[model samples]
Target: MTDHTPSSRSAARATRPVRTKALSALVHGICLSLLVGTVAPAWAQFKASPAVSPRIPGNRSLSTELKIEGMQATTDYILAVVNQEPITHTDVDKRVARITDTAPAGSRLPPPEELRQQVLDALIDEKVQISHAKTIGMDISDQELDASIENIAAQNQMTLEDLRNRMQSDGLDFQRYRNSLREQMLLQRLRDREVNSRIQITEDELTTFMKEDPAAQAEVALNVAHILIAVPEKATQVQVAALLSKAQAIQERAAQGANFAQLAKDNSADTKTKDQGGALGLRPASRLPELFVATTTKLKVGQVAPVVRSNAGFHIIKLIERENSAQATYTQQRARHILLRTSPQQPAREQIDRMNDIRKQIVGGQTSFAQMARQYSEDGSGARGGDLGWAAPGQFVPEFEKALTALQPGQISEPVVSRYGVHLIQLIERREVQLTEQQQREAARSVLRERRFEPTYEEWARELRAAAWIEMRDAP
Candidate 1:
């Protein structure tokens, strides 16, 4: 949903008099969760990390008289319990709106009871995960929270006061909304620690996946868009026939030049792509569903594949574009750095001071970059005169990359603090390289990681649910 322009939100509040209806409109209609794309691995999948959505159509409500049994309940109403943390009806409503918002604009909602149950379950799972984060002492600092809130407001093209005022008029508490944003960031960090860090593609596994299998080595990423005609898990012959006919009709319409995205949004049952007009994004063939890869591989760009059936549903796919993985160009840098990792004993300021001194020494000719790195640096590269042979784009984290990219071929960087430590980076040279044999294996490792990300994340989420103590309260 597009953000509420100040004028529009003001108009909404003025016409409604009280904020309840306007807030619901915000929750169910225009308001959105904070998410923009980060660099995802080249795989066609849902971009939004599926978290329980929290949308209370208007500003956070503190009203006493406006209580509607289940829907208008306050902070005290317990809808479910996860690890003894109370999940309120308001929480469930917000999440339900969030979930429904992700669905195609006109997609049919589940029965209310069913939708509520699903939202409750998702919230419980989320609560347990959040509880685990707290138990481990993972926290968002005030500075970090403030920055994230600012980012969210910027993304919505609003100032912080503008967002707060809009929420205020709708009866949504601005502070609680900020808390929600912080939790979203926390969940992301928790998953990066628990799920992403755990998905390791070992050298042996990568080698076998690439070299041992001739086919895997030649795998490519395809840009595929698909419209799904969903068939229920079980159906009679009559239901099957109806679905197949519907799928065929949609295919013929797309073949005849109807807007595929609009067609998919209006008709497709695949929730992930329904709103996207059926864009699956780019997916490595190896990671794609076997049926999808096989069917679409035979077609050229702009050609529609025949409707393919699986247990879930019928897929009508269009081949958008394809790229050869072998043709991937990689930028490589020969760099080195002197590191001073901050510890409880050595604070960040001390580390920065030390690196600044080291840089001064290098400039004064008292020591070379390599000599200083060996004597004062705290990394494995210190042994090699601070030479990082050749590194690729994603080989370093974003902080380090930003620092590295700012250096000239022979220049020294001011001390930069990354997660690993404080570093004074020096660039020796940079060059573009084709995928060498070694690089191919590394690329294959990335492919394996991409393949495993969704499934691994799903498994981790499932484990979180399974391990939690959940008690469902009777429906209000």
Candidate 2:
């Protein structure tokens, strides 16, 4: 059923109140999970690492009586459980409050009871995953939790303090917010460990996969660099003209053998790439900004273009290299493990020591990587023996990719650290995949795996929600 339009509520509120409600609800409606573009103030003040969960001071009630005085209990008192965990009606109500106006301005909000049920269901699903995380012993460290919260705040374009104040003004409790954030972090970690880690494409597989992907097949990676003279956002036509002229002179210097990197560092207005000699990296030609593609595609590697104009400013582009994509396929080992985050208080040394010991035990035949993962690894992969099935070259963090690349079949990598945390990786098995075959068997496998992943992930979520204990009472 279509959701309800919240205009009635807006109409009932005074103008200023409506504006505040709209602003808060509108922004929250668009609030993305942990990863997203731009920073918000919420990220700054609410940063909590995985290790930062100080257990609730003590078990407490999970419901609050609304003080509406004359209003009756218009909504049903729903109590549900995911596996052994209970989800109170209040939990559902809170989520509904955040999402009531989320549908486009005109849609009707679902009935309060119905919305509560949905929220309850979702919370249950989340709990299942959390439970699975525990079974596999996945953990979020203090540092990672803090960084994720900070990142969310930044994405929302709010400083940490500002986000906290905004939440307070909106009647949202800080700890509740932290709990919500932690759950999301856990879900993401679980997905990575369960599904994403297992997905992989070999060089040949990637080659074939690329050939089949209309988007990739239609495009090629172009290595390019540029020198730009920019007009300030508020610059006048005259000022713009002067900047363009300056660009022309700089281009001349570049053409006359001045080092492009040095010149870019000194003169380019494209700050993102200026220090790297205006290098835009190996980006798909089709996706390059129109002006960039138009100018650079026409020039051979090492050739500099005449002045080009784009939204940012005027630019001179140079093509460095181009890679034509071909058929893709992969055959590789898949393994999983949990992660343990490192922090100043629980430094890398501590995590390293712990993981190293696990590695030693596993190596000495005292324990399996899977057992060690479940017992100790901090990554969500711990649920499944640190199995990241078959991955393509660039799928993992560079450090992880490097370590994985160095392992032989059945070989377990020494404890390796990535931005996420320390990991104990094991090599399952490696297989050769030929995309040239008619069935493109391996490619077909990859496609099937991709298709199955979503539902499997949903099931995994269901599993986590089935196993967690959550309460929704407001803080005292």
Best by TM-score: 1
Off by over 4 Å in 1: 1-32, 36-76, 105-112, 212-219, 225-283, 286-291, 300-302, 309-315, 327-433, 453-469
302-420, model 1: which lDDT tens digit per residue?
Answer: 88877888755787899888866577655678888877765545655566767888899898889799889789777766777877677765455445667788888999988776534
How close to the true structure is residue 330 of candidate 1, measured as C-alpha lDDT?
A: 51
Judge candidate 1 against the unseen true structure and give its global Cα lDDT, from 0 to 1: 0.63
Candidate 2 Cα misplacement greater than 4 A, ranges? 1-216, 327-353, 356-390, 397-421, 424-476
Q: What are the lDDT scores of the predictions, listed in order? A: 0.63, 0.52
Q: Which ten residues in a row have the lowest lDDT in candidate 2?
A: 17-26
Kindly list the per-residue Cα lDDT of model 2 for residues 420-441, writing each as its tens digit.
Answer: 4466676677675533443344
Q: How many collisions between residues are there in candidate 2?
A: 72
Count of backbone collisions in candidate 1? 13
TM-score of 2: 0.41
